[model samples]
Target: MKIAVLGTGGGARSHIAKLLELGHEVAVGTRDPQATLARTEPDMMGNPPFRQFLAEHPGVTLLTFGEAAATADGPVINGIDGHNAVAALTPIAGALADKTLIDYAVPFVYQHDSEHPWPTPWGVMPKLDPCDTDSLGERIQRALPDTKVVKSFVTQEQATVVDPQSVGDGDHTMFVAGDHADAKRRATELLKSYGWRDVLDLGPLVCARGMEMYAHLHSAIGFGLGQQFGGHFGIKVVR
Candidate 1:
């Protein structure tokens, strides 16, 4: 399958690498392919430039967001920055029509004045907009009525998400929720390819509120575990 990974960030890179290893052709999307490839320094997240990544992994194509989506043969992974995702994706809705879009973005508002700020090692924690009342997944589905949107991979770091066996011996649970049953199945199939044995279908895209809202808790747990940065852990829903 030719998969379109729509970002050049660390999370998107993880999916791209894993997809390539899975024997799928990958085309990465970015706001500006030239700018992304021209970067000599690391990104804010410390991930190397896209050109370096492409150098290490040959055969990967880098294209504009619209071009990448239009070329994908199957599922599209939405890894665009959470806050900017809707605006970036809306213009390319036609290319995504009728395709299963696995969106794992958390809507974070980085610049906000919180009366009671939750400070983290990096800075104050970013607040989630459209948080409890609505979610990023629902918003994307609304914006792209023709796309089958599945909310997933938001609960863990993308690295852990693509390699479940790295934590708890692959015993942890992954969740997927979407209005489209076939889209959820496609997401589950991708998760299985990632070695996830227990994927919980939480039913309905509304459940994405919980998944996206869990970002703070995820950060809290990371802090508690003394992991000041990207948390390398997973949660299991044991019945």
Candidate 2:
């Protein structure tokens, strides 16, 4: 199976590494491949440069966003940052048409003004735009009418998402929501391949509202647990 992961951030790296280990041909998408490769410094999240990651994991091809999306025969994981996702993906909708696009983006407006801003240990918490009325998943689905969009993997860290067994012995649950049953099934199958045993289908892309909104709670839980940044944790939908 050929897969395209559209981002070079830490979260994207987790999926890229896991997919490669599963013997899938992985093509990574970036805004500027040459600029990404030219970077020698670590990113804000302290992730090493993409060049180093590519060196360690040979045979992973890096290309422009459109080219990478076109190369994938199977699912295309949209790991692009939440704020810029719609703009970036909208331009490449042609390449993603008729394909199962498993989007896990939260609609976070990193730069915004509010009279009473929510402050976190790091800084002011980013605001969630289109919160109650709409969601990023629905926005993406609306933008790419020809694509099957499934909202998932937003409730937990990507590392914990790929390797669920590390937390609570894989007893926790995962969720997927989309209008297209077949596309949600594809996302579920991929989750199973990642060793997820309990996957709850949260019916319809509108349910993505809850998933994306959970980002704040996820961060709060991490802070409560004394993890200032990038905490390794998972939440279960006990039933």
Candidate 3:
């Protein structure tokens, strides 16, 4: 599959690495090519080397976010942080028409020196912003009504997102909610390819409100626990 990951953050890097591990042709879409290259080089320096690394990993490519989104054959995963996701994707909205978009984002507000206490150790949690009333996924869907937007992978930690094996016990489940059946199926397949064992379709784009709330709840749990507990949550399936 040809997948384009949008962003240069940790989530974007994780998606790129995991997609490569799944043997997919992955392209990182970043607004700044030089900056992305610089950021990614640190991990490869003095190992097999950047040039040699590229030779070995020919499937991974980096392109301008717009160009990559315009040319993607399969799903385009939005790994950009919640704050920048809509704007970053705005330019490519037309290109994304009738395409499947895997939205992995959270509407988090970063408040420093404010009266409200931080929700998590990371001082970030999903807070209702002015546009978030309809939920971020729904807002994105509204912006690109033609594009099929499926919300998934928002609750899990980046570490657990890539390696569910590290979570231990049985397995962790990620939630999927979207209005399009075909898009949900595609998102599920992509998640499975990245080694996600359990995926629950919560139904429709509106369910994104609850999904985002779950992310907030997870953050609250981490805050109460006084640590970054990203992979500590799981689902109980009862017959």
Using Cα atoms with residue i matched to residue i, what is each candidate's TM-score against the true structure?
Answer: 0.99, 0.97, 0.83
Tens-place lDDT digits, model 3, residues 42-138? 4411232233444555677778887787777899988777766787787788878888998878876555355565545444444554244578898
Local distance difference test, each candidate: 0.94, 0.93, 0.73
Evaluated against the true structure, the overall lDDT of model 3 is 0.73
The regions of model 2 sitting more than 4 angstroms off are none
Output the better candidate (1/2) by TM-score: 1
lDDT (Cα, tens digit) per residue for candidate 2, span 1-239: 99999999999999999999999999999999999999999997899999999999998999999999999899999999888999999999999999999998778887588899988877889899879889999999999999999999999899998999999899898999999999999999999999999999999999999999989899989999999876788888877
For candidate 3, what's the RMSD?
A: 4.2
Model 3 misses residue 223 by how many Å? 4.0
Ranking by TM-score: 1, 2, 3
Ordering by lDDT? 1, 2, 3
lDDT top scorer: 1
Q: Is 1 or 3 the stronger prediction by lDDT?
A: 1
Q: Worst lDDT window (10 residues) for model 3? A: 42-51
1-239: candidate 1 lDDT, tens digit per residue: 99999999999989999999999999888999999888999998888878999998898999999899998877999999899999999999999999999999999999699999998999999999988899999999999999999999999999999999999899999999999999999999999999999999999999999999999999999999999997999999989
